[model samples]
Target: MHWRVPLSWLAVLCLARLQPSQAELGGAMCHKLGLRGECEVQQDCMCLCFHVTADNSTLVDAAYFGELGYELILFTPLVHFYHSRGILRSTVGPAGSAPFYRFSPHHREVDVQRHYCLGPYSNPSPHMYRREWNFDAWIPPNLHEQYKGQGQAILGDGKPLMIVHNKYNQEWGAAPTNFISISTLIALFSMLKDRYRIVYIRPDPRQNLPGFGADHNHAEDFDDHEHLRKHHPKVLLFQDILQQQRNGTRPDLNYNELQLMLHADSERFVSVLGGNSVIASYFAGVNIIYAVKGSELTGHGLKDREFDLVYPRLGPNGKGTILTVSTTQHLLQAAANEFLQQQGDTEAGRTVLEASHRTHKPHRS
Candidate 1:
């Protein structure tokens, strides 16, 4: 829902870590958020501490603490939001807030732990203290209304629907992040289109590719659009992604059309180290199809199987088999079909999709 962030926010986030005056409480800005008391940056039993200055504003020093042994996972303009793949903007905060500082959650579950930090860091948010609330992982708290369109996508009347999440095209060092090149995704889609309508989801052309140290190419540098157009003319671009960025601005969390689009559409989710993978991993019933490839691919655990929801977990019925498939060519189509059959199309409004006897693409083949 928001537009291009002003340069100021971008500038502050440049380092994402800075030395704060240890003596001062929350900064002036922090005071405005209501953290009046002296706010010292100290590690909680589980939370990362933020420095409060004279103004009472909180300061995030993720890198410094990370060096001291705290694990820091920072994503930026290159990381996609869990709700969609077309747009790439990264932050662990609920609403794509900038320069987030996370402490190891009281619970390892990210979906449950994030609510503690909602709103201003200065506010009386749950994140200020640690407590265990007994609730299953349902959905992330404070989701903007737009992220609610998932039900519509589930309604193909049992026809197969697939969401292929192509994370980043960039490589981490010499290692690949289980990346399926756009051309390959196009090929897979071609193989699947006859049986199931497939959606190829990836970062929008306007977003930055991962700039590990030097991949910071201009937005125009991305060939996602070019490749999709060139090879897979029939593959859809997960509509939400291109539509929002057509005029030059990437989609914002404030009005996440991506969340709505993915929710309404995606069923069998496939991606490696992408945000969409994160969504599928935690949200119950959606089948998982991934194998780790990047050394740092687990960077934010965005695409890793290890990361999962916390408090609100799906009942046993929500559990689906996490398939293991190799990148070998001969195995892909058959494996994908088997995976889909294991977790068939979810009924509209149901969190768990029922397993169907439907064999993807068999009739056509």
Candidate 2:
């Protein structure tokens, strides 16, 4: 595992210590990473091209190229995971530092003019850590039409849909620190369960979906599945939805594909940090991301962080609203305010929770 840099000042210090011309900095940094003559460094501070590993990293990096209207050739273990999100040009490669061609899209493995080795972070490259994120060009395909309303059937209700995703695996340590608590969910659910058809999602690698796997090998520290089923019976679980879809006509739809279709049809999402949150931000909507700790909360400073400036541009119009919260209280407050339109101590807009199973055609992408 990569060493977790807990302090944000340390990153700032490293940047401050770097003293070189933009061109020299690029060349020096490249050579320092043992890419001396292999990669061509551009005159500008940013590299002309690069490759990234990991699911979220690949999405952000590929989207950067997509925004520039440049075709990106991705080599990822989860080929369909990226492909389902509208990344049509991707190839399968073994995970981790394995032997593979970096530039095979043009069949040019030798004498490549531009390409850089990107660090395994969500951002495209270490130098472009402050780069603006873009998923405006990655509008998900209209699979509802292709699959003949498989996503529409999943909506299962006429109420406005809200996608909720949470994670409870070990992150940065032995304990799971950043996750949406059950109590918080109950509180948020009580407020909006009547107004929205909540779809709770938590992907498990045990499902054995092709080109997809767990966030990491870390064991799950907590399970909210049974709790939600027992208490919030009206809330629709994604696994259940998948099983229903499997028994239907379009059983070929992969996990990622179904998720993309469902998300594209909805306008409200609630997710925790990690790849779940990243994926939720892709669709044009209001994404409430609860992240207590991580590089996302620390790096790039508080005023100009990626969550504030970059993540919002993930939508097609570059106008998606992403509200980041650090605590469960903040999450509940934001939900009540944004989703419920209730502020501080005001119980206005509270409605009785009612189940809605009436199927309707969801909005097309």
Candidate 3:
């Protein structure tokens, strides 16, 4: 559901009187409009709100009104709005309880399930809100003709499923899947929906940035799809790694190491770009699986050695087709151990080894 800042003249009057100062007015307006904290606020105070009720690009045009003195409010009615405005079957309730509403399917004997409730104090109460207003009420027959004529997209057979993976890269020993993983998922789902009579699978916890390094790099790569496709072939993978790295707060692996990893895995491995060398893999296509740590890659070895062994090959198209795991903790620990061992601090090396060992364990849900 989306909330629209009330745009009535009364609302403007309230705003003008309640907040005389520009700063206070801007702050209050933003808060009431449910805007993100980073939304650009020009000195002149122009603002536009967008609602992606249908197409993803529906909000693009609305975003360009930049006079800095106007407010744009976008409204998106609920999906069930049309389905909840008809004659509903009713049920009597216990004494003091609100009356309930139901709507059974045309040919069914049993009463329909109750999906919405109407309290005594609810607006348009009792009969209309409870007995007569069914949340699943059938669409009006006249409107059905119009709807069918509109040629709306139809959902193919089967249910939509979403897959969400967390800390996906830490297991692969390289980096995380980039925006390619997500964009690929979206593209593949769209295609599959057209042919297989299958519903779309929406994957979640998809990395947007691996960490600070990735965050910085993403700023550089923004909107330069051509540069990203050429210079950072696995740009999406780079974003995932950078996002994770920033989240983990790891400080090692500066820009040079990040660039090297990006270059190193351009064709096959999905490097998280910046941050540690941890990599994660995600399966594409139907019925995909996500690989967690310990299920694969047991026993100890150098960070690079382990990474080379675990990072899987991309498909013939130089794009990921299956899932993998990745991480940088081991590399960091290994580096610390090597430094301590070089200084002849055997105890410190041992301590680092133990700590690294513990770090590799999977976090419990």
Against the true structure, what is each candidate's TM-score? 0.46, 0.60, 0.17
At residue 149, what lDDT does model 3 achieve?
Answer: 17
The candidates, ranked best first by lDDT, are 2, 1, 3
Error of 3 at 174 (Å): 15
Show model 1 residue runs off by greater than 4 Å: 1-160, 169-176, 204-224, 239-255, 294-321, 324-335, 339-365
- Model 2 pairs in collision: none
Candidate 2 local lDDT, residue 111: 14
User: Which runs in model 3 stand beyond 4 Å of their true positions?
Assistant: 1-197, 201-365
**Relative to the true structure, how large is the alpha-carbon lDDT of every model?**
0.35, 0.51, 0.25
Give candidate 2's whole-model lDDT: 0.51
User: Which ranking of candidates, highest TM-score first?
Assistant: 2, 1, 3
Q: In model 1, what is the error at residue 44, expressed in angstroms? A: 16
Question: Candidate 1 residues 86-172, lDDT tens each?
Answer: 112112222222212121121111111121111122111212122322221122322212333443532334445566666554443
- What's model 1's lDDT at 157? 48
Candidate with the greatest TM-score versus the true structure:
2
- lDDT (Cα, tens digit) per residue for candidate 2, span 64-162: 111000111111211223344432232222111111212222111111122233322221323323445433223332222333344556665588788
Which candidate has the highest lDDT of all?
2
Q: What is the lDDT of residue 306 in candidate 1?
A: 33
